[model samples]
Target: MANGVMIFMALYPLRYLKTKVDRLGKADLVYLLTTSVISIAVTAAVVVTLQNGITTYLLAGVASLAVWMSTAWWVGRSRTDAPGTRER
Candidate 1:
């Protein structure tokens, strides 16, 4: 859950930078770092609550990736359909 939230939070500014600057700059790095820290904290909390060892971590990773991809797809579709937005 925390990993998903961190990635979701990071995605907006990263996408914005990609569109406006054509490259990731310093702000993007900061966003990534922040996301990493948040994700680590969340993952730690989850690990403490689970008893299945590596399987729990694997499941969490898979779920987080799914959430990230779904959110990215939704955001990409919305942006493309908006007036004056360019298709990628």
Candidate 2:
């Protein structure tokens, strides 16, 4: 069931991106691809861990969750940084 749901969500994005292909820059493309994989993996891992009481899956979920959030933050930070601005 989880696999089916995740698969549908993954494929649905392709349909949505069909008309937006030309509008998305390379960075946007990379961010989207990275986030999609991380989101799916993390979501499934957390769900499975909860449903099965498995510590192994819990570790996987925590690790991926950190990665998912950090990626989002990094992308957002990059987008907001100006050409001449330097954070000290």
TM-score of each: 0.40, 0.45
lDDT, residue 47, model 1? 64
What residue pairs clash in candidate 1, if any at all? Answer: none
Candidate achieving the largest lDDT: 2
* Candidate 1 TM-score to native: 0.40
Over 26-52, each residue of candidate 1 has an lDDT whose tens digit, in order, gives: 223344445444545555556667858
Cα shift from native, residue 11, model 1 (Å): 10
lDDT of 2 by residue, 1-88 (tens): 4456567645644554434332222234456567668777777767766666556455655665576557655554465342333567
Worst 10 residues of 2 by lDDT: 18-27
What lDDT score is found at residue 54 in candidate 2? Answer: 57
Give the poorly placed runs of model 1, Cα more than 4 Å off: 1-49, 80-88
